[model samples]
Target: MSTKKNNPSALNEKAGISPPEIISSNAIQQIKESRKKQPSSQELIDGILAGNITALSRAITLIESTNSNHLTKANEVINGCLPHANQSIRIGITGVPGVGKSTFIEAFGKYLTSLGKKVAVLAVDPSSTISHGSILGDKTRMEELVKDKNAFIRPSASGETLGGVARKTRETITLCEAYGFDVILIETVGVGQSETAVHSMVDFFLLLKIAGAGDELQGIKRGIMEMADAIVINKADGDYIKKAQLTKVEFNRALHLFPPKKSGWIPTTATCSALTQEGIDGVWQTILDYLELVHSNHYFVEKRKEQNQFWMIETIDEQLKTHFYNQPNIIQLLESTKKAVQNNEISPFAAAQTLLDSYFKK
Candidate 1:
C-alpha cells in the first residue's frame, strides 16, 4: 500500500487514466532557465504572422516595454505586420462598474466562436501598475470562454492613461490581426470619459448599462452616449426584464437627440442578460446591421483610414509630452514659472508663451 501511494502512476490508475511522465523539479527549473534566450522580436513577429499565440503574447510584451532598446525592434515588427493588418473588426465596449461588461463579452464571444469566427479579447485593466504588471482579472472573470481554444484574452496594464487601455493597445490590435483573430474586442475601464479614447480606435463603440430608477443616464456622460454606436441595457432578465424594455425605449429617444453617427449608421438599443444569455444574439445582429449599413456606404474604409491617421498623431503628441515632462531642465523651468505666476510676476498666457518658446528652442 505504501509503495502504491508513493508511485505517481497509482494516482492516474485510480482515476482510470493512462500514466504520464512527471518531470522532476530540477528538470522544470532547467527548462525555464533554457528559455531565457527568448525569441527575438522578428521571430515573435514571424510567429504572430503564422498565428502562434505564444509569439503573439511575447510580441505584445515587447510593445508594452518602455525600454529604449525594445522600441526600435518593436517598430520594425509593426511595420512588417502593417500590410497584414486592418482585416479584422475592432469593437470597443465601455460601461460603469458592475454593468456586466465582461459577462456580455464572454457570452458574445462564445456566440461568435460558435459561428466559426476567431475572437481575440484585449481587456484593459486600467489599474495595473508598471512595477507589478497586469494581474489579468478579466481572464478569471471570463472563466468559461477563456477555456475555449479559439479565444485569446489579453489583459493590459493601464499605466497612467485615463482609459484602462495600455500604451501599446493600438499595436496590440495589429498583432491580434496578424495572428488571424478576425474579431477583436477592446474593453476599456468603465469610467465614462475614458471610453472616448477607446472609441477613437474602434470601428464600433458599444456602451453597456444596467436598468436603474431613472438615474442610469445621469451617471453616464452625454459625450459617451454621443460616441456610442449602440447602447446595450444588460442584465435584462428575471427581475430586471420589464425595466430593461423601458430603459431601451428611453435610450432610443436619447440616442436620437445626439447627432447621427459618422458612418450614418443609426444607433441601436437592445437588452441582454449575460447571465442567462438572453438577447445576446440580438445585440450581435444589431452590430452586423450597423456594419452592413456602414460598409455599403464606404464609411467603413474611410473611417478606418481616419482612425489610423488620428492614432499616428496621437502617439506623436503623447511621446512629445512625455519627453517634455521628463526633461530635467524643463521640470525646473515649469516649477519656476508656476511660482512666478502665483507671485504675479508673469501672466499665465505670457508664461505659457515663454514655456512654448523655450520648449521649441530646446
Candidate 2:
C-alpha cells in the first residue's frame, strides 16, 4: 500500500469527475443554531409586548390552535397580554357577499396606516367543506395593505364556528392590541347571524352595502341592520357613483327608522369606492366621531363591561355543553338514547334528562 495520503480532488481529476461542493463551517453552525429550542411562553409574551410582529403572529396561532398541549400556553399568553390589551379601537365590519368587504378593508386599513396609525386586520374566511381550512385569500385581495409595514393582516378560518368569525378571534384581537396596534378591524364572513357575534365583541359595528341590487333590504336581516353603527355603500366609482349615492340616502332613512342606539350615537351612511380609495377617510372619521361620543357619555366603558359578561356566560355555556357531550359514558349513551326517543320508547325530554343525569353522576 502507498504511504501517501489520498487526494480526493486529484482522484476526481484523473477520473474526469468534478469534486463535490462543501458547505462552509459558518453555514453549518447557522443551521444548527436555527434548530435551537422554541421560545418559552414568557419569551413570547415579552416579544409581543415589545411589538414584535413574528411573536404576535405566533401568539395568535397558539390561540387558534385546538391542540390540547397548547391550551395552557395559549391561556398563559392571553393572561400575560390582558393587561396590555383593550387600549386599541376594535371595529367590526360585515357585509353580504359581493359587497367588497376585503377591498374596503384594504382601503380603510391603508388610510389608517397613512395617518400613522398601526392597523391590524383580522379577516375571518369561510372554511372549505372538504378540507375545513380557510381560503385565506383576503391578504391577496389587499395587495397594498399587505405591503404596509405598519399593517398586520391575519386571515382565520371560521372552522365550524357559527358566527362567521374564528372561535379565537376575541383572543387574537387581544394579542394584536398588546402588540401596540391602535386600530383593529375584524372582517366577518358577510352579513347574517355571524354579524351578531362580531357585534358583541367590537366597539363599533359597520355594515357594507351596495347599490341597485334590486331590493337592498330584502336579503339583510333586520337585527343585522340594527347592530350596525354605520352602513357604507361601496363600489361608488364611475357609473355606480350615482347609484351608490342614492343607496346612501335610502340607508340613512332606513337607519333613522331603527330605535336609537344605546350609545346615543346615530348611525350614519356614506359611499366609498375601494377601487379608487375615495370616501374611505369619511367612514373612518365617522368611526372616530362615534368613539368620541361614546367615550364622552361613558357608554363605551359600560358596553365593554357588558361584552365581557356576555362572553363569560357564553363561555360557560359552551364549556358545559362540550363537557357533557365529550364524556365517555355520555357518548356511549347518546346513540342508544336517540334510538329510544326515535322508537317512542322514551320521551325526548326524558332522554335528555337521562343523558344529563349520566353526565352529572360521573
Candidate 3:
C-alpha cells in the first residue's frame, strides 16, 4: 500500500494528459474543472483603471491571440475598457537596426517618467525571425527602462503576420491608456522603412537615421519620408556629430520637397546621441509641440478616428485572406490553379476564377 493516506490515484485517478479519445465528456469535465478561469471583464476593466500592469498585459495578449474562442471575451474586455482609454498619446518610431531606436526610447522613456508621466514601449521585431534565428532584441537594449516602475516594455513577438506587430497593438495601446499610461511608444521593425503599417496607426510618426552616405538615404524609401512627422539623426556625438548635423539639413531640405503631412504639420529635423542622452529632451519637446498644434486644430481626434476605421477594414481583409487559403479544398485548388497557370493550361484570369469559384462553392 502507498504510504500516502490521501493518494491522488486512490481517489478516482485520471491520466495527466488526455489522449485523443479522452477528449470527450471525461476530458470536457476535467477541462471544466482544471481550467483557470479568466478574470471577468468588469474585473479586468477595474484592474486596468487601477493601473495594474499584469492586467494590462493579459488584456493585450487576449487581444493579440488568434484563437477564435477568445475573440468574444477579448471584445468584451475592450468594450468594458474603452471608456477608460483614449487618454494617451500614441507615437510611432522606426529606424534601421543600428540607429539606436532602443537607446533613444530608453532615454526618452526615463525622461517622461521623470516628468510624472507613465510610458509604455512596444517594439515590432519581425527581423528576428530571419534564417539567423535571433531573438527579438529591443527590450534587451532598454534593460534599465524595462525595469522601471513607470514603464511597460513588450517586445513584439517574432514572425507575427502583421508586420511583426501583434494584430492587436492598436487595441493594446487602448489597454495601456486605460492603465493610465500617458504615452504609448510603438517601435517598428527597422526594415526599409516602407512601413506604412506602422505609419497608418499612430498620431505622430518619427523616423530615426544615422549620418551616412547618400546610399543610406537610398536605403530608406521615399514613401516613408513622406509619412514622417519628424526625423532624428541619432549618434549625433563622437565622429558622427558633424555628419549628423549635415544630415539634418539634408532632411530639412528634402522635407520641403513634399507637401506638409496630412495633418498640416511640418516635419522637424533634429540630431541626438541616444546613447549619451543628448538632445533627447528637445525630441520630446518637438513631439509635445506637434501634439499641441494638431490638438488645437482638432486633427488629433480625427486622425485617431480614421485610424480606427482603417484597422476595421484591415482586419476584415486579413480574415478573408485567411479564410480563402485555409479551406482544405481551396488549398488543393489553389495549387492546381498555380500549376495550370505555370504550364499555360489556363489563362491566369481563368485560373483565378476557377479557384475562387471552387473556394466559394466550398
For all candidates in order, the CA lDDT equals 0.85, 0.88, 0.82
> What TM-score does candidate 3 reach?
0.84
Model 3: lDDT of residue 232: 93
Q: What TM-score would each prediction reach against the true structure?
A: 0.85, 0.88, 0.84
Question: Which digits, one per residue and each the tens of the lDDT, describe model 1 over residues 1-362?
Answer: 45555446743546666578888999999988978877776788788899888888888888988887788888988887888888998999988878899999999999999999899998988554546566669999999889999999998767776565634998899988988998999998777346877887898999998897567567556788888898999998988899999898888887778876668888888998999988889888888888898899999999888878988887888788878877777888999999999999999999998888888898
Q: Write the per-residue lDDT of candidate 2 for residues 13-46, one digit (tens) a residue.
A: 5665667899899999999897575677998999
Worst 10 residues of 2 by lDDT: 10-19
User: Against the hidden true structure, what lDDT does model 2 obtain?
Assistant: 0.88
Once fitted onto the true fold, the runs of candidate 3 whose alpha carbons sit more than 4 angstroms away are: 1-37, 127-134, 158-162, 192-194, 213-220
* lDDT tens readout by residue for model 3, 182-265: 999999887643267777778899999989756555655678888889999998998989899988888888888887676879
Candidate 1, superposed: residue stretches over 4 Å from native: 1-33, 128-135, 216-220, 331-356
The pairs that clash in candidate 1 are 126-164
**Lowest-scoring 10 consecutive residues by lDDT in candidate 3?**
125-134
TM-score result, candidate 1? 0.85
TM-score of 2: 0.88
**Which stretches of candidate 2 lie above 4 Å from their native place?**
1-36, 164-167, 341-347
Report the error of model 1 at residue 125, Å: 1.0
- RMSD in Å for candidate 3, one decimal? 9.6
Ranking by lDDT: 2, 1, 3
